[model samples]
Target: MHGLVNRCIEVFLRSTYGNALWQEVAAETDVHPDGFLTWGNSPDGVTRSIVIASARRLDKSAGELLEDVGAWLSRQEQIRRLLRFGGASFEEFVESLRELPGRVKLVIPDLELPGFAVLSDARGRYRIIAESHQSGLMRVMAGMLRGMADDYGSLVIISVARDRIEIDVVLPDYSGRRRFELSPMQVRP
Candidate 1:
């Protein structure tokens, strides 16, 4: 597994729970207390162990915990900026998901992101099929979709299954959206 993925989990644990909880999780998983390097690689077993131990200590299901991690990730400025680059509206963003893996690869050549296949039904409902070696990726994607919906000021109902996610956009533009600029320097204080 890529270190970035594990590092995200570590950051999520530390920021959401606390450094102490993260330390306990690291010790329980036999991982180094300093956590993963952003550009390094670790065995997939290490990632699984950390998730399992963290979930057990936190008294939450792994899926639930991973989902929270996804939400936390979306709130990060760098990640949010990357996701916001998908589109201006939620619907457009959903449509752009097919290119997400490639986009991410362009930035991090060695990072292994999940492949997303976006499908739409006659009723305008969208389904995202996530393919990855890691488990619970779909759940994380569900959390990210929910967070992005909020960022786009849209109302959506999202459901997660083992390998796919369903999204029902109730209102594409339900409220005011956060400002986004093509260049950070364009922002005014």
Candidate 2:
């Protein structure tokens, strides 16, 4: 298992463990990158997912590092500001409808539950596909969100009651008509 994971990380990034990159990432998150703690509930639920992205000590101008720092800061706070820190509330997640490196502004679309959309460079026509929240579809929606969840992306909830019984918030930003059907499922205790 360790060899498989190490090989995978090496393929995507510059380094794996106990390197300068890992040290920097640990400093950014204020924890020891080499040691982590994970806890779960029952036998089927995971309460945490730890992703470690390490890079070689990137040799860049001070301006570049500052730019990266700014981007990270903005990303950390963006979801709340966009959602007004109100409305949909559950687990915290930020979906990147469209994102790329060094983009100053992000285009995000939200539709209240059981539905999602596509985003481009904010210069073309955007399309949305949706489904009304129905009782039988909860498990399917849950599975979709769970399966596609990225460390920094979002799960769209169509309604609070029926669509998303397993997530945190649902924001509506896309065009056209929408029907919020879910009635907000009670989170795990």
Candidate 3:
């Protein structure tokens, strides 16, 4: 698995739960307490072990924990910027999901994101199939969808199954959308 994936989990666990809990989970899983390198690769087993141990220690299901991680990830500036590049509105963003894997690949050649197939039914209903070697990714995607909905000021109901996610955009523009700038400012020395 890509180290960035594991590193996100590690950051989420530590920031949300505290460094002590992260260290405990790391110890239980035999992972280094300092955590994964953002650009390095680790065995998939290491990620699974960390997730299992953390979930067990927290007394939460792995799906629930990963969902939280996804939501947290959405708030990160870099991730939010990357996702916001999808479109200007919530609906447009969801439509752009079909191209997400390729977009991500362009930035990180070696990173493998889940392949997403988006199906639109009624006007505001979307069904997304997320395929990856890792388990519980659908839940994470579901959480991300929810977070993005809020970010775009849309009201949505999201449901997750083993490999699929359903999103019902109750209100496409329910509130004020968060601000997003296309370009970052250059810092002068």
| TM-score of each prediction | 0.94, 0.19, 0.93
Give the clashing residue pairs of candidate 1, or none. Answer: none
- Local distance difference test values of all predictions, in order: 0.87, 0.30, 0.87
Clashes of 2: 21
For residue 108, what is the lDDT in candidate 1?
91
Where in model 2 is the C-alpha error above 4 Å? 1-18, 35-115, 119-189
Ranking by TM-score: 1, 3, 2
Worst 10 residues of 2 by lDDT: 40-49
lDDT of 1 by residue, 1-189 (tens): 888889999989998889999999888888889988666888988988898899999899999988988888889987998899999889999899899889988989999786868999944489988666435788888898889999999989998888889999998889889888989777655
TM-score, model 2 to reference:
0.19
Candidate 1 Cα outliers beyond 4 Å, as residue runs? 132-135
Q: What is the C-alpha lDDT profile of model 3 across 126-155, one tens digit per residue?
A: 999865644477778777888999999999
RMSD of each: 1.5, 18.7, 2.5
Of the candidates numbered 1 and 2, which has the greater TM-score value? Answer: 1
